[model samples]
Target: MSEKTILVWFRNDLRIHDNEILLEAVRKADKVLPVYCFDPYYFQRTASGISKTGSFRARFLLEAVADLRKNLQGYGAELIIRTGNPAEILPQLAEQYQVNEVYHHREVAYEETEISEQVETALWKLRLNLKHFIGHTLYHKEDLPFPIKDIPDSFAVFKKKVERDSNVRPCVPTPEHIVTPEITDAGELPTLSQLGLDEIVDDPRATNYFQGGETAALVQLHKYFSQDDVAVKSKSSRNSGSNNSSKLSPWLAVGCISPRQVYWEIFKHNQDGNNQNASLLKLELLWRDYFRFMFKKHGQKFIKAKTAEDEAPVLAVNELDFNKWAHGETGVPFIDACMHELNATGYICNQCRQIVATYLVHDLKADWTRGAAYFEEKLIDYSPASNWGNWAFIAGVNDAKESKYAIAAMQPKDMVSDFVTTWQPSPIDEAGDLMHV
Candidate 1:
């Protein structure tokens, strides 16, 4: 007879501390085995030529998994790594170990959600209970003031209601240790080449610098708050990515770090009488949670204009202007500079993201989904909700009634004054006709 145990399947919520599944699995099972999968589908090409998970995010994920394994090892737990479908691998392991329950974070993105459902179906066929928990956002799905059917369409309305009436439940406490299961043998993690990609370094000029995983995330919080010079400049200089902001998105995106951890760290600092930048930093986190909750409420629909439920926009990928916009030769200096940065380093400022996205959707008259897909391929911190939801909002397909921006000369002026002049050393002269705004 095989040993009985519970399987804790790791997904975006990677850390051990304050993780709902990690804490609960230890308490309920006689022995617990942790598992993570490098799904082959993640590295495969999309309909387009680009790899679904590009090199930058792939490298970051590799680092995050390494960090997570270390953290789990510290608790006398071992993580099982496999490169295949969870539906197939998980059920096989469950039966092989005589496991009854498989616990994991509840994912909302369309593909992941479908995969989870398939995994559940497979496990049910084996007579196992699949336990899914909400761990990504601060607001638990059950604790929401309204059900998914009732969540408001507008962000402002949702934000006001949650802030006023909804409170983030305290993080579930985590145990320091769990009984190790009889499963002893483990496999090695794949390198970039092993995962069908090549290793790459950070762009020399890019302002952001942070490693993947929980330890790096904690170190960032310490430096962001403790370093006097950097902290003082961050308030005004955050928009300038090359120097003044706390780049925590990569870790948070991969579940190497929890937003709640960042929130509590700053909250504690505020309580200790350091309030100058805490409020602003906290609001940035609120934005992250807001995008996450929006996805939860809308389900797969979050991807289409009305959302993923709606038909995909009619986008012509062969258009010449799109190629120009993508390659940083769009004739708008600021837009070009930002696009250049994103291409070189899988990161871009939030403000520039909105401007470039608007340009691609409205000015260039291209499909918003194309722009969303491109970002999904490139951004290190890309979340399914924020990337698609934002494109939908910008294209005037989702919540908005009218388009708020125009392309003519507004981009040139803003780029020259704000972004281009700052980043590009030898600025080019803008012809009079170029100032069409």
Candidate 2:
């Protein structure tokens, strides 16, 4: 009798802890073969002509993959790495290993879902099953108070309902030991240059302090919640020069950390006394869940801006101006400083993201997709559902109250004079045009 072999396909969810798919795989299979693919499509150039995976994100992912490989080895399993389409590589691996079935976490976004579908179809052709588990969001799909299609268009309403009715289940424990089939030659991880990205220099002004992987993610979570009262100070300190927003998004985005883990930690911390800070953090987690559910419900249509005819009127974008915005040369000093920060680093604070996005959509009048695509390329913490869904919400595509044409009402001189003086010392005229002082 042959041992039953299963393939564990690692996608965005890279961690071994509280990983439902990996847990089930180990429980059922006599032997497991773990695999990760650097999908070429993800590294290809976007329609906007920038490399879809920028150097900052590329380097982080490389670090994450390396860490994942190490962790799997600790469990006596090896992660076989490959570079190509997952739809193709997975099936070939299945054939080579004679895998009885495949297991992985499901993705909500259209492109990711499509790739999963392709792999499933390929596996079916080989008479093998491809199993998917929900692990991305704080709430599992089955545990939602309402069906995904019935989720409230308003985030506030959705949050209220979920808080009233639902609870986050406890995290699955990490496996003490994982069994592996007889296999050798666990392949080497790729470099940033190999992934078609240029080497990135560390930015002195970057506010982000994240390194990728499950181990790093755990260290950051403990440091943020247990070491100090960082939570109590978050709301007051956010958006100011002395900002202290919890910089947990990068790990969350990559599934290096699970939302349930974060939720429980904060919940436990609040037991000491009344802590509105825990409520605020949990609210942010709900918002993350809301966007993911919205993606599951609406699919690609969720990415569009709301227009009267279901088609947005094409705006005459000034390519030169858009380029300036992309490269941090926008003469509006505050906006320029934010853009420069984003370009040099892979991140900007949440407040800066909104300000720059509003400036581009309402001030520059460029299509919102352009800004979203650029962010996709740059952000190390990019989640397709959160990134595109937030863009749509900002662009009035989501069921939020529409934004007024108030860009003209904002006086650049009054709002950003001090910030500009510190971060961008160049003189600007009343209209925010660069001028010789």
Candidate 3:
């Protein structure tokens, strides 16, 4: 009998550490092949006129993939890189590598699931199985106390039950060595220009560069967990004039580190399970699980479908207010500061994100999906469920009354401070008091 080979396809789960799909492939087959596809669909400019993957996100992705390849090399394997549809790329790689099966972590979002289905269909024709592993969530889906269908719509109730009843599974051990067939070519990593985007000129104030990789992710985790103000930082307001909040989201978004890894490290550092600061940090990770599980339970519930060509921007109004908000040109100082930081660094504090989002939907009376699409393009930490779910909540599905209240409560008293001065447009737009003129 010939030796069996399994191709491990890398999606959001980029790291070898704590990755079950990588382990399962190695355990099941005699040799393992690791691959990451830069699917063009993700990099394309949608009709919404927003990039599917913007400069910041695309660059971060390239860095993460490069790091993954390097890590795989350390473990005695090469990361096979390709730029194309996964549906086309996987089948071809399967044939080239003589792979009996292909394994990947499952995704809950609509487009990701659709692409997975397409790849599954293509593999079916070649008589190779497309195996999927559920490794993205901190808690294994099977271990959940309630089924996806039964998950409470209210986040409060959901958090309560999961904490009380469920247990987070241990991290999958990283293999000492990953075996692969001799390979002459593994393809080149694509650049931002190739992905149809301008190069990123990072803002000067961005002193803390977010390096992408499991290596960097682990470093940041250790440093963040070691801080004495873990509770204060974990509960840091999303509404900040500065961009110096937590840095774990981009790593989490790219899958350089698993939520389980972070959770366990907190457990180790805190020792006692009942530590409040540790619980808050874990709660932050739990929010990620909440959005992902919510997506699984209900598909695209928050997004309103486009009715006609008139709604071509697709998610929200694509007019002046939207463009101004996207560029941080809006006259409102605080909102402008947050948007500028987001546009420049691809990140902003959660408090600022909510404030700016509210300004767009409530103050500006523009559609909410527009802000969601912009974030989808610019945010380094953009996850479909979290981005869209938060936007939907801020958009206030029940009524405008709730958003009105939220905006009033969130307005900063000292909006004219130095943080705003640093980010707002030069010359201060004499009428700076204006809102999105």
Identify the candidate with maximal TM-score: 2
| Superposed model 3: Cα runs more than 4 Å off | 229-244, 273-277, 302-318, 398-409, 412-419, 424-437
List the candidates ranked by lDDT, beginning with the highest: 2, 3, 1
RMSD in Å for model 2: 5.6
Candidate 1: Cα lDDT at 66: 87
What tens digits encode model 2's per-residue C-alpha lDDT throughout 246-354? 5678888888889899889988888765565456567678878877887898787676645467666658789999999888777777888777877777777665666
Candidate 1, run of 10 with poorest lDDT = 428-437
User: What stretches of model 1 exceed 4 Å from their correct place?
Assistant: 1-4, 228-244, 271-276, 306-318, 400-413, 417-437
TM-score for candidate 2 = 0.91
In the predicted model 2, the residue pairs found to clash are 306-397
> Candidate 2 — worst ten consecutive residues by lDDT sum?
428-437
Give the root-mean-square deviation of each candidate in angstroms.
5.8, 5.6, 6.0
Taking the tens digit of each residue's C-alpha lDDT, what string does model 3 give over 201-239?
877876447788899989988876665245444665323
The numbered model that scores best in lDDT is 2
Better of 1 and 3 by TM-score: 3
lDDT of 2: 0.77
Q: How many backbone clashes does candidate 2 have?
A: 1
